[model samples]
Target: MPGRDPADRSRRRFARRQWARRWLAWRYLVAVVALVAVVGGGLWLVYFSSWLSVAGVEVEGVGLLSATQVRQAAAVPQGEPLARVDLDRVRARVEALAAVRSADVSRKWPDQVLVEVEERVAVAVVEIGGRLQGMDADGVVFRDYAQAPPELPRVETGATTGSEALREAALVVSALPADLRARVDHVEASTIDEISLQLHDGRTVEWGSAEDSELKARVVADLLAARKAQHYDVSVPGQPTTSG
Candidate 1:
């Protein structure tokens, strides 16, 4: 081996260099092929594959509304790509139902559309056309009750009372503490500024505007607990008075 020619050694070294260059080129080619395969597979899975298509709709957070009702309202097309479903459009449709205050629509990956809804809760009932309508805390009248539920307070509005007055009455009722609110028989709103609460015991509370309602609620509760009265005047909560 020590007697090898220099030209032979040079030729062997050159052959090794050529082989290494070929291996480096093959590595780049394999990497490029792998990258292309990954990109193509991702595109097919998201846009052209049926494996991730919508198969059904799911509903949540519904009490007054049935899951079937919410699904129908959502109107999510069966077999459409789940990633392609328009969530905003679905949400708007679900919210169109009177009982649904708001809704959130989303894709439950792989095959379902999810609809979560917030239903309106009644804080009081109002008589409109001899039918009792449930009113939420925001004073939006919705849902007709066949018979008034005993737990919720009623709101009595004069023929001249407008929606604003009814809103004020709702605010006054909502401000009262639960224990105190339970004692109220009904609320009367002659005008936005003229709100009153009538108790079941033939007693009345002159509640003024919706302003200072929290203070007024506290004052009325304290006055009732401290003394027996036929009439309570907490219109000016800072200086409350009562009379029998």
Candidate 2:
């Protein structure tokens, strides 16, 4: 056999080096794919297993509502997967509760649900069908009336029984000045077309419509300030008359 030429030997060495480089490139790709598979498998196991069950529920920003009541309102079951919980649905349910003004629901890592509730602050006591109840600005009755809340107004309206009436009355009460608000004794909404306010000072404000309550309240305050009178008739806008 003839001995190999130096040129042939050099060429063979170069080809072997190229083959080794290609093999190493393939090995690196396999290693990367294997690592990704391992990580994906681990994550799938953790997500599918019962390890992420809800262990507890946390409530925050609650004042008028009790923790138990808030938890009941949320209605999120323990041991349920945190991922499966519907935060928006829970928040909507909580808001449906008469006492809750607004609600925020979120998940805490791995094992807890965080619920923050903003309770409705009572603005007045409303009389519906002769039964007195406490209500907030959204016309939701939260509690039965007792002695009137100090510094809060009393709203009485024929339309106060339903949600629409409550909403209108709330808008009216919200428009009153804070100082005048405490002075208001009772508000009467005897008809959908008219509303009247009774002041603690033995005066009555004839507020015919819920429209422009803010403007009407301001006018009423100005009249009361101008003359320490007993009654104001503001059913007609831009022309207010007072009586003593």
Candidate 3:
């Protein structure tokens, strides 16, 4: 065939350019639609879908408390959106149990609420109303003991002893080293500032206040290792004294 006319070729080229422009416009619209669809789908799955809702609760770090008890305390809403669950509220509820010292609540994806609890550990035992109560290092009287354990030292509070005194006594007991603690028979607190420890070997340590407890413990340990005495006064750790 003879060479095509230049005008005819030019018109075809113009038409192709218009078509390319229109395709570009449609491509932008398609991309926007796809983005909206993805965002909407993600929102639905996270906020309203049953597939990601809570199906069960898992408990951990429970010793004194049963899993059932922790679950009941948590009260995590079943069938609720896991992403929408209030973890802080769940944690607060679980920690409200007297035996639970702290708790962590989290979502296990695809349908589980995870609750981890740190339970109170007894550092000493005290008698109240003819019943023995377990006291933690923080001086919290948490659990009642049916019978006091032989390894745990007892705290003896006199009529003048108040809550502060009990706390001071607890601090004193908690500050003792393991070997010293094992040797402790009982602690007596007449007031917040007057706390003493009686050892199994019939030796007494007069420890004053919860302040400077670490220093007092060190002094007591040193005195016991260097001397034999029925009485030790580390109330002033800087000037410790011992006498028979």
Candidate 3 deviant stretches above 4 angstroms: 1-9, 225-228
RMSD of each: 2.6, 3.2, 2.2
**Residue-by-residue lDDT tens digits, candidate 1, 183-217:** 99999989988999999888999998999999998
Tell me the whole-model lDDT of each prediction, alpha carbons only.
0.91, 0.80, 0.92
Model 1 misplaced regions, further than 4 Å: 1-12
Q: CA shift at 235, candidate 2, in angstroms?
A: 3.0
- Model 2 agreement with the true structure over 1-244: per-residue lDDT tens digits: 2798989989999999999999999999999999999998767655555788788889999877788888887889787777788899989988898888788899898799999888888878876667778888776788776566666778776533456666777778877888788778888776544677888878998887678888888888888888777778888769998887
Model 2 stretches with alpha carbons more than 4 Å out: 1-18, 21-25, 159-162, 228-230
Count of clashing pairs, candidate 1: 0
Candidate 2 CA-lDDT value:
0.80
lDDT: worst 10-residue window of model 1: 42-51
